[model samples]
Target chain A: MQVTMCPERAIMEHVTSRWAVLVLQLLSNGEAWRFSELRRELEIVSEKMLTQTLRTLERDGFVHREVRPVIPPHVEYTLTPLGKGAANHLVALAQWIKANHPEVAQAQQHYDAS
Target chain B: MQVTMCPERAIMEHVTSRWAVLVLQLLSNGEAWRFSELRRELEIVSEKMLTQTLRTLERDGFVHREVRPVIPPHVEYTLTPLGKGAANHLVALAQWIKANHPEVAQAQQHYDAS
Candidate 1:
């Protein structure tokens, strides 16, 4: 399926993406995180998806990826100022969901019942 | 494909959805909008997607839908307080994207070049 690409559409899709938002939220709090570290932090994420999400975010300039020249190769990910701005909003959204999960759950139950 | 459903996951997906964030942001600024009015406001959205997004947001209690008994049917959508909270954050994210689109586009061009 060809997903039509528009600038607004792309940005919305990127930020609200399943793993992208979580990755941004995590990096926002931590400042920087290594690839494996991020994978471990978000246990449910697959390696492929994590890598893909990071690349997409990096391409969008919201994420900065630093590769360290080493024997084993180390990569670190952090947010750019633009990303930090996005992450700040994401954190607020995440916090809201965490704080109001109960009410949302109740509403969902009611919705399902009716 | 059956996507695994989790509350946090669902909430993130719902708010970050293509039309949902835009709709929430619009409602946040205007308080309430009729269905057709919203479609007119956001010229790119399809009626099916708009209704689907509204249903999802309503189920989550972030959006409140009011139905007025009239000849042609009048349904107005506004952010619930919970939704208002979410919208506040979404607006911040949207603003960031708008402000930074140029840089992001430049970055995408750079990425495509190499």
Candidate 2:
């Protein structure tokens, strides 16, 4: 694989990445999330991974990052219009996977047996 | 990340993978593809990678592989009904990425400049 992927593919990869999917799904709820709050919600995500995922999504225009000039200058993340558009599709895909889990599990069992 | 991924996340990863996305999009046209034909269509895909992707999809029940009994046996791969369901969503995502390429490009340029 080439070191630098095409922009479209790269963006697709970014949006569909494991962490990105979860992040997008959460942000789609229309509530702006503080960085710490998001980390709390996503229990398994490392702080470093979450930060990198947010930066990538922000660069891709799917996320809006705002640094609130509060006591400590907290950062809030929300889905941009473009991000919401992408998130809708990703959320649907995630739902589909959830709904079809049984079918896929059966398939895996059959595949492993043969 | 754990060596063994959750089933739903793993399935999501399999379907959205770069080569898998292209493969599903191509197969969604309702054509069964010979391995060589797919290799030809996806010019940059390595033979090993394509083979591995196909096996993964097949095991996941998203792809059906059939072997023709002849002088020289040829294996053909097609999307299963489940595969088609996933492919429809994937193809839509790919189209979305293509259509929104310019917006994303501008965002990247702006991001790079800052």
What tens digits encode model 2's per-residue C-alpha lDDT throughout B1-114? 111137777888888787887888888988888999888887899999999999989988999999989869999999999989888887778778888979999998999999
> Where is the poorest 10-residue window by lDDT in model 1 chain B?
B1-10
TM-score, structure 1 vs. true: 0.84
Pairs that collide in candidate 2 are: none
Instruction: Tell me the tens digit of each residue's lDDT in model 2 across A1-114.
Output: 111237777887898786887888889998899999888777889999999999999999899999899996888999999999898888788778877878988888999999
Best candidate, TM-score-wise?
Answer: 2
In candidate 1, the residue pairs with backbone N, CA or C atoms under 3 Å apart (3 or more residues apart, or in different chains) clash, namely none
* Candidate 1 C-alpha lDDT tens digits along B27-90: 8874678999888877889999999999999999888899988988799898888888888887
Q: Considering the two chains of model 1, state its CAPRI-style docking category.
A: acceptable
What stretches of model 2 exceed 4 Å from their correct place? A1-5, B1-5
Give the winner by DockQ.
2
Flag regions of model 1 displaced more than 4 Å. A1-9, B1-6
Per-prediction TM-score? 0.84, 0.89
- Candidate 2 lDDT at B71 equals 68
How do the candidates score on chain B by TM-score?
0.86, 0.90
